[model samples]
Target: MSRRRRLRSRMLALVLVGSLAGLTAVGGPAIADTLSDKRAAAKKQEQENAAKREQLAASLEGLSAELGQALLDLQAMEQRMPQAQAELAEAQESLDRSQREATLVAARLQDALDQEVSIGSTIEQDTARATRIRESIGQMAREAYKGGGTATSMDIVLGAKSTEEFIEQYGLVSTALRTQTNTLDELRELQAQNANSQARLEAVRGRVQELKAEADEKVVEADAARAQAQERKDEIQQLISQQAAKKAQIEDQKAAAEAEAAAADAEAAKIAAELAAIAAQQRAAEAAAAAAAGKPQAPAGPVGGSLFANPTSINPMYVTSNYGMRLHPTLGYVRLHAGIDLRTYCGTPIYAGRAGSVQWAQYRNGFGNQVMVDHGLVNGSSLMSSYNHMTSFSVRSGQRVEQGTLLGYSGNTGTSAACHLHFEVYVNGGTQDPGPLLGR
Candidate 1:
């Protein structure tokens, strides 16, 4: 390699050594635990279905016929904007962390490769040194054989002219023997070191392969995180845009909604009110019956369980919203949905719930084209049923009708938005939950 390239390689190899050493010193499990915790937390947030539902339901439930509904729309929008903004912030943070992880993984992969290259170089040097040692040792042995091995101590002493000459010959032989011994020892040490480095190089290469895979996964995770963040950002922006338009819409509908509510309020109260028209009709009917008999009246029949047939045009009736006190999520005010709202199309047939007298079949103030049917005495009280929000009526007041008598056509009239049948069951005068009565 060129000088510059070699220098760069060395630098990278040094980085690899330091990084790997740190990892080894800390231990793999401890290092993995930190990243594992973060990843687990991010994965946990993947189940955001409930949050999505809350957002969707809140947005949809706010638009209805009541004036409170328009006001509800505003409140729901207020709640959603802030919630979306907060989620967006979290998503952005997660994206940032994932990107950092990707970058770290890329660096580690490169370092592992550098460590493998550097270790391979060390192994080569060791092999070269061992070869040189072997050649040198071979030459020394051949020279020794040519000279007939070594002079004995007795031979040295006898051949010597003086004590100094004997000492000098002994010293020369000792130095030659020591040189061969040192060379052989060094060759053995180099061979052992080279084997160790070869193993280490293989391990480094394996680690490089592992790091490459981890790097790819990190890249994918970072991209997904970025997409999530972007999606949240776009959603928040859309909500912001809708916020202004919704507020303007509420202002436009405010007067009409208010008028509708005002008209419906008194009639709505009468459904559950003690001083209701149904109560008066009940009292009058009982008096007329007693006078006809000229004796005490018979005990009323028992009323429990499913007391009425399906009153909707649907083959099998389906209730859209149940009868209960529904509190607006944002407004925190409870409103009574006094009856069950059934899924009915515009101009669909509306049935009498049971055999009864058709008392009123005209447009009541809030009920639009309303039809009230008196089911007569039941369980010592008068039972009545009302089918409201119809386009037109077929029956009139004082008409005797059998069960399933077609009274009107369903519509989106009065304080209603969509086309449906609002069915109410009143015992004596007060309206109650119609679930039990409606179920067949």
Candidate 2:
């Protein structure tokens, strides 16, 4: 009975040991598979989150660039505002001066006209007096002729009685003839004076007409100048208004971008924290798996290469100018030509020279509608590219682009004299010849 009891106890202990071993094998595999599934799901979530983060980062970079550009533009506009105001003031001053001169001229003309009128009145009075004198002289001559003309003097002398009387008659006749002669001479002198006055009046009238004409011309010039000045003032005001509106728009965009960036940053931080936790858990699981399997981990893959490609698809007709010292066409002085000028028809499509982020894409002062790209690093040097005198742009600041990506269209904007592409390559913030890079 003791031997049978010992055998049953040993069999029950063996069965219990077998059941515990089977439970460990099945339950351990199930728990490992559950952990692995959880790890995979977490990794997948992490990858998705990483992709989202990358996208958000790109967007944030673009927004920052846009904000920077906006600030620069606003500053530039602010600077130009004073210059425009100064120009307007100068124009107004010139217009005012012209108007004052015109007013003076007009006053002078009125004075000349008044003098001419007064001279005309004096001439009319002189003419009337001369006519009256001529009529009186004619009447005297007719009366003398009706009274027997030259014989009247002799009859007067004969009508004297004695020698004394005859002497008196002769004296009387001589005296009367002398008086008539004096009167005729006086009338002739008056007529000559009237003729001289008329001639002087004609000259004065001509001078007055000339003065009036000059005054009219001055008034016309002043009116034109005033009109031009007004137009310029209006244009400047309109430009200021436009700049203000643009600044406001940029401010709004910047505010929205900042808000978005903040949200994205928070979300990315949350995702990073979750990823970190997941990574720690995964590392622990992997380490455990490795320990269980007694194997080593594989290495990661290699990184990709960074090389540039041609910017545009279309072949240019010819290079208009190469980078070097040359005389400027419009500026009329020796200056450094910092870029290669590529001649092409207006509205030609422009492309990116390399895969990079856009630094700026807007209307620059001298460059016109320009686009600048930041090629992070190439050939162990920081590189950048710029396209100037563009008519329009397709890309915005901080946007990522690939080689041959369309950036804009060629134009004759800003300081450009003709339609062309001004291509520049910058190395370490200094301009360099792009011929070698372009393989031209």
Candidate 3:
């Protein structure tokens, strides 16, 4: 054989050996179509899950808004209740005070009336006494005139036997005259006093009447205020009841959302398991081919020659770095890497390794433009994958997307040495080898 032919045969033998070494790692070709069908179905399911998540998020937000409004309204009602109760209590207390005042005034008026009656009786008695005294004086005058003017003061005085008796008689006569004059003056004074007392009693009676009237009006107003306050209290209670019902509804919604998320997780796990099985079968086929060729095999990891498509298919032999290595290009330190870096040109269209829904698409710290996808259920757990270091991103949060959709263009935005895609697969929340499954 020619020297060039010998080199070519040796290279082909090396390729065959590498294929056999990786065969048992994945599924075979007999289930390729089945696995593809399942992956398509899983993609559709993931899209549905994305839509459901959006709906649940919106519903939760609306419930939160309503709950907040209800709480505010309840607080307002609670604050008003105290004021209303205070007003009602003040009104009631005022009514009570007025009623008590009315009672006191009525008692005072009764006392005044009794005093007026006593005064009137005393005036009547005084007037009767004055009349009797005047009649006695008139009779005395008639008798004296009948006896003619001969019966004088000197005769009257001489009628006494001794000088002391005559002086006594004179004193008695003077005292009678003064008593008559003073009696008339006293009668007039007593009448004036009685009139004043009656006037005062009337005034007191009027005040009592006014107080009684005011008390009745206050009672009426207080009753009305109490009734209004009671109505308001009842209304507030009704609102509280409605809020409780709304809270229960929100709880129900939350439960449903949690259940949907659980179902999506379980479904994703199943799909991941199926994809793993198919990949194992394909790897087994490749390994069988390598054995028949009889050549040395390469290590089972990401390699340039693989069946998977890349963001840029050109220069497939160049690998930027291995996944589990150390060497921070930007920070200049040895750190364990979580994902493989594939070298590619800028603006390369990144594709999904397996079917999945767009879980997240946004700019993140240290990742710049990135996209994470939920592939499907595998082994009773959800499998997720991430594509980072992209120049541009098209998907949005809560967006529904399918496999093979244009994620973004490749770029070196994160901690990278060159423009490449940082690919990662997560199995049950832990990172796994994605290169072999992608046939890289």
Candidate 4:
């Protein structure tokens, strides 16, 4: 009976020890596990919130950069428009002057032609007068022949009945002959003068024709020059029109971007506030639980967050687009985006997202001057990052860089529609959604 009591007591002691171990496991390890799980869940939620915030920031940044570049382009075009207008005005003035000169030349040519006509009419009249004089001389010679060649002053004196009559008849015949000779001589002299005048007029007409031809040539040349100038002015105007259209489009985009950015920022702020509230609640609950259980509270801050830093010094305002399948801006087709687009202006500094060695630093097709970094590994995965559309780069292929290291300046190179950064993340050898990796 004594031996049976000892064994039962030993068994009772073992039972009590097992019961206490079970209680300790339920009260301590169970509570610790629950707290740890809660902390992990909260950290995950926080990371998701951070990722969303980052996306918003990138979008705002992209929009701002696009708007700024558009404004700059518009300003440059506006400044050049005035110069184009001035050139057009000058061209018009030149054209007008040419037309005026042409008109003057035409009038001069008409005057020259009129003068030629007048001179020709005078020559015709002079020619007719000469013909009449020749006919009259022929008639006088016929009359002299019909009256007999011997009918002279001596015959007139012989036929006279008295001395006075003889003297009068002789004087009359001599006076008639002398008057005829003088009239013929004057007709010949007038004909010769008319012929000389006609010759001079003909020479003047020839010179007038030459002058008119020269004037006509000048008019043609001036017209051609005016047309050329006008065409040039028109081309400039066309260029101005194109630029204006581009400016308008940019302005519209800017307005939209600004509105979107504002909304995104507000949303992000709201989300951040909510996350903060949740985090505070989680912290308070954890503290309360720890106090009740007589254990330490869970640590604060993000857990298993992104290792990469922002690729820019300034915090991005919003995300333009996330890496995924989307419609191409220019190609009008569904395609893989393969990267995240961040808002950035021309000349904005670009930085490495993680410490790595540069795999490539050169101009790439459709990506512009790009920098690709091989980060070796992150979270047991081979990771890589690329920065695209840079204006200039401070790093080179085979070079080493730390996180946040300046790589280059942002730009609108390659096939980009605006100035911005195309940030890409890779896992192993393939592209992946950069959102989660960025703690989005």
Q: Write the per-residue lDDT of candidate 1 for residues 1-440, one digit (tens) a residue.
A: 87435534443443242111111111111112366775664454333433433333322232345443545455556555555555555555566666566667657766887888889889888888898889898888898789898677788888999889989998987888789789989998998898899889889978977876676566566567657766766776676678777777767765665455555667667545642566666667787888898967555554567878888879778777777777743334566767787778888888888898987887766676788888877767778888888999999999999998889889877656557788888876777677898763
lDDT of 2 by residue, 9-105 (tens): 4333322321111111111111123767857755764575544433222121213445534544554565445445545554555666665665566
TM-score of each: 0.56, 0.46, 0.33, 0.47
For each of the candidates, the C-alpha root-mean-square deviation to the true structure, in angstroms, is: 10.0, 36.6, 32.4, 35.5
TM-score for candidate 1 = 0.56
Off by over 4 Å in 2: 1-61, 64-80, 151-159, 235-248, 259-440
Per-residue accuracy of model 3 over 1-440 as CA lDDT, tens digit each: 97434433433332232111211122112221376875775576457554443322222211233332433344444434444344444334444454454455445545554665675677577667757767776776786579673334787576989889888878877776777678667667756765775676577667645644554454455445445545544554565576576556545555443444345335335544644664455455556766888944333442222323453434553445555645421123444455566656678777765566776787654454678776554433446677877888877666665666677788756433245677767654556666764665
Cα deviation in Å at residue 68, candidate 2?
Answer: 7.8
Model 3 Cα displacement at 86 (Å)? Answer: 5.5
Native-vs-model 2 lDDT? 0.61
Model 1 residue 73 CA deviation in Å: 6.6
What would the TM-score be for candidate 4 when compared with the true structure? 0.47
The lDDT for every candidate, in the order shown, is: 0.69, 0.61, 0.54, 0.64
Q: Which rank order by lDDT, best down to worst? A: 1, 4, 2, 3
- Tens digits of lDDT, candidate 4, 307-385: 6777865685345688776642212345566678877878999999889899779876556688888775444445677
